[model samples]
Target: MKNMVEIRWHGRGGQGAKTAALLFADSAMSSGKFIQAFPEYGPERMGAPVQSFDRLSDEPITLHCGITSPDIVVILDPTLMATVDTTAGVKDDGVIIINTALSPAQIRKEMGIKGKKIFTIDASGISKSTLGREIPNTPMLGALIKVSKLLDIEKVLDDTKKKLEKKFRTKPELIEGNLKAIKRAYEEVKGE
Candidate 1:
């Protein structure tokens, strides 16, 4: 696991955290990388806190357990910070990508996070404008890609488009909206 990168996702149920991890795994796999993605749920209800994990590496991954220390953490629901220890187990030099309207510095001050790199994006606003919904997962994925540099943006978008097409067959508009959301978040995320 020398080149391995582990990612932990924090979001609420019905917010597509699981879907985002799956999409990221699919994209990485398409790029010829070894990948694993899975979700851990609490009560399995809307607004319930949920966590998902992803491990990507150039070599095969043998670990089949929970990610205790992740290299990167993606927080789709900023509100979860109030109840969840979102930073728990993250490496000291880890990167944290948060979906919020606040700046990275503001988030760092509010959360009292130090040392680790922090990136922030208004994913909810991006999703609402691009997809006409408040689902922040897809936008968060874009922000993660931008911050992590894990995969090519074009490849992720192409792979994600194919997946979305399968799930939203006749809704070309929905597919395009999601793509737009990803691109917007990719370009709009701010880091410190």
Candidate 2:
């Protein structure tokens, strides 16, 4: 993640794919890194397929385009791996982080993928247990950091906690839940 690390996120509408990218960027920015976080919207609707992109680097990013070749592809919605070609433009040595209850071995076999690395996490489970809902964005953010080492985990937690405090001001309880979600996911993420 030193010089332009590209990432692509796959998830369904309203599932926090866009937020994950932004949170990643914001955390990187807090650590003095340059980042771009934006989504590719297409006929958007709740539960519809969605994709977001992120680019983090030590230097300023000049290119302004969707990520065609990502170093890491994170899938928050396991179902998208069925209908969408999630790995289409990933680099040969790319790492894929999928939010699934299944293990990496099972996922790799099910997806018929080879060569590239596949990382799996029960993000939905973590979020549901910690946040009282099935939102996997924050948890997935933790997984992304664990898998890619793109940003400092402490910085991400610090920045994200501050951001969450502002967003969920009236619901402070949710803040702790989200923080727990991130930490749990980071520790629980399994790679292969």
Candidate 3:
């Protein structure tokens, strides 16, 4: 697991956290990398806090337990920061991508975070304008990919398009909107 990258996602239920992890795993697998994507939650209801995890590596991943320490953290809802320790267990040099309009410096000050790289993006706004909804998961994926540099953006878009098509075939607009959201977030994310 020399090149392994663990990612933890924090978001509320019904906001596509699980879906984003799955899509990320699928995209990595499509690029010939080993990946594991799973969610950790119990009896959850809509708007309840939830967590999802992803492990990507160039070699086989044998561990089958929870991720206590992650190399990257993606926060799909800035509100979760009020209750969840969004930076919990992240490595000292880990990258954090948060869905918010605030600058990374502001988030760092508010959260009292240090050392780790922080990226902020208006994922909700991007999703609302592109997908007609406020689901920030897909846009967060873009931010993660941009920050992690673990996979090619084009390849991810292609793989994600294929996966999304299976379910949104009838609604081409929905599929396109999701793609647009991802690309927009990728470009608009700010880091500090």
Q: List the candidates' TM-scores in order.
A: 0.97, 0.97, 0.97
CA lDDT of each candidate? Answer: 0.93, 0.91, 0.92
The number of residue pairs in model 1 that clash at the backbone is: 0
TM-score for candidate 1, residues paired by index: 0.97
Model 3: weakest 10-residue lDDT segment is 158-167
Model 2, range 1-192, lDDT digits (tens) per residue? 348899999999999899889889888899998889999978999999999999989998988977999999999999998999999889899999999999999999999997789999999999989989999999999998888887788888888899999999999989999999999999999987
Per-residue lDDT over 1-192 for candidate 3, one digit per residue giving the tens place of the 0 to 100 score:
699999999989999889999989989999999999999969888999999999999999999999999999999988899898889988999989999999999999998888999999999999999999898989999988899999999999988888889989899999999999999999999997
What CA RMSD would candidate 1 show? 0.9
Per-residue lDDT over 87-187 for candidate 1, one digit per residue giving the tens place of the 0 to 100 score: 99889899999999999999999989878889999999999999898989999989998999989999899999888899999899999999999999999
Q: With candidate 3 superimposed using the best TM-score fit, by how many Å does residue 79's alpha carbon deviate from the native?
A: 1.0
TM for candidate 3 is: 0.97
Kindly report which residue pairs in candidate 3 clash with one another. Answer: none
Instruction: State how far residue 138 of model 1 sits from its true place (Å).
Output: 0.4
Clashes (backbone N, CA, C under 3 Å), per candidate, total 0, 0, 0
